[model samples]
Target: MTDLDFYARAVVDGTVMGLGQDSLPEDWEDRLGVNYVDDVRKGLMRRDFGLVEVSFQRVRGIWRCFGVGIQVHRLDRGVEAVVPAPVRAEFGEFGSPVGFAGVDAAVARMGGRLESANDGGSTYHDQFLSASTNARVHVVAQVDDPGVGGTSVGDVWSIHLSWRKNQDS
Candidate 1:
């Protein structure tokens, strides 16, 4: 399977490496198959792991991971350069060549369900709930204006898996 497929399944299974944990695994880089750069600014810790970016915050003197973002499309030239080849290859639709249909099938296969969807003129958004993790899985895609008529959901921009609740500080 492609890296995108692997990571997407991980999100649904609630087994994403180093996710929602107080500390990263000793071999996190090797497990994730990418080197990461850590950024600690504005009291938040962000780790850019090429294909996956994780966000952490300090709680009770411990660094706790709360969210993860996966890169799908080549939105930013700089970030696009770092996205792995496997991920880039799976960049169409809902981060798959088959688009939303493929994502729906995969999610169902993994015991997840689509919670909601929105077509925001130039962008499309899909939210999913993982059965295992109860985490929120969000997908954002660019909407292509064909100019002839109605727009179409284009390539996926990004996917985010977050454990944070709306009321969380």
Candidate 2:
């Protein structure tokens, strides 16, 4: 297999994107010799979370699957809607900002059919699976920040990945 045959898969976890850790993992500051800071944006983390990007091998006959968490905050009168119960359980939680204009709703929104619990908030997710390793996918997350600047919402997205098998060039 040529160098290009090796594919890279990234899974972003956080409160907004819910890439995984609210606080980064111990060994994750830098791994696989890739610069994460460049793939992730911080200023946006104060509001949106779970945004992860990476560069890996591109191969043939490989299938890749990834997941990310998304969080949305809406005030009692703000624009973003609430996330239902079932959605929260799977995605994460629904929350609000303290001393802010609205309520808090956090959900595990992903890409696929959802088993909804209630009605009131906006819940969503997106997914793409490729049978070929040479394929790269783009995942978009939508999060609402009811409170900006001060409260932070402390939203952030981290990324991780798992891969196996080598392909030919």
Candidate 3:
């Protein structure tokens, strides 16, 4: 395997280990598929609860990974409940009586500054950037009550975390 290939594998392996998986997924190789275009490399992996994507580009005469991202989907309800506490601790807690206030407070405590928030008709999206790692974590929630103009953390459908190398670090 090339260096980029190794890096991509490492990302998947690390994610699996970090998330406390017993072993690499049976279809790990298939999930951690790789594709190439020109000189860029894209790696994708899917987990029971989410997906992981990593991208690398040739820079300064060397292959450099640009970003790594984790996207949790809402294909199944109660998915958020299964998120490991240790992982949640990494980003701070969304808190009990989960709601927008808790999520906002969690981001602040995690050193993530609000970057943007938008309403997408049925869903509300909020993006936060962590000062420590320069990574971004976005939360998407179902609009429970438009009249209230707020989203409940319990209504959160998905959460995505992304790490980009030196874009702002």
Candidate 4:
């Protein structure tokens, strides 16, 4: 079985266009690797980027990722205004930021399937199971329309993935 962190990294990197922990905010790490245990012990901890908030949990050798959230910001020198349409289309015809359609495609590409789905107001949550392993990945995507610098940039989608430890690993 693959390690939870390993599988999770694969899923996260895969979904987020090859971004890794190194790409996460420096506040998310420590000498012990991701500092996930401390974050969880201290309650929901977050690593903030000007336009994003990331949370994760890895404790007792298990993995539990909270979700990555992106805030809509107006186009600026450093801020990029983007719609994940092309990215989502590459995965599948998932409509909107809160739709689990793209996630369905992501899981399929990883050789998995949607095991369950839950709707929670502005957020959509789903779980995927690996066919070749016992890993379970949970994903949460939020639909947000935040005004950045007084600009109304509509519906921005932010997503995060959490993975359970593989028993076999």
Q: lDDT tens digits, residues 1-169, model 4?
A: 1112222334434333343332333423321123232233443445544333455544444343445444323113232223233323333332222333544555566556545434343344344444433333444443244433332222222333443233321
Predicted model with the maximum TM-score: 1
**Reference-based TM-score of each model:** 0.62, 0.21, 0.36, 0.33
State the lDDT of candidate 1 residue by residue for 1-169, as single tens digits. Answer: 5444554565576545534444452334545556678899755778887757777776655556767776554333443456644344444322332244566566677666655534343335555555556544445444445432222353344566666533333
Residue 3 lDDT (model 1): 44
The parts of candidate 1 lying over 4 Å away from their true place are 25-27, 75-98, 117-124, 131-154, 165-169
Per-prediction CA RMSD (Å):
5.8, 17.2, 11.5, 10.5
Report the error of model 1 at residue 167, Å. Answer: 12
lDDT of 1: 0.54
Q: Which residue window of length 10 is worst by lDDT in model 4?
A: 72-81
lDDT of 2 at 139: 25
Q: What are the per-model numbers of colliding residue pairs? A: 0, 29, 0, 1
Candidate 3 per-residue lDDT over residues 18-98, each given as its tens digit? 321222333233343332122332332233323344344344444434444443332132324533333343443332223
Q: Which stretches of candidate 3 lie over 4 Å from their true place?
A: 1-43, 49-76, 79-81, 84-97, 117-124, 131-134, 139-156, 164-169
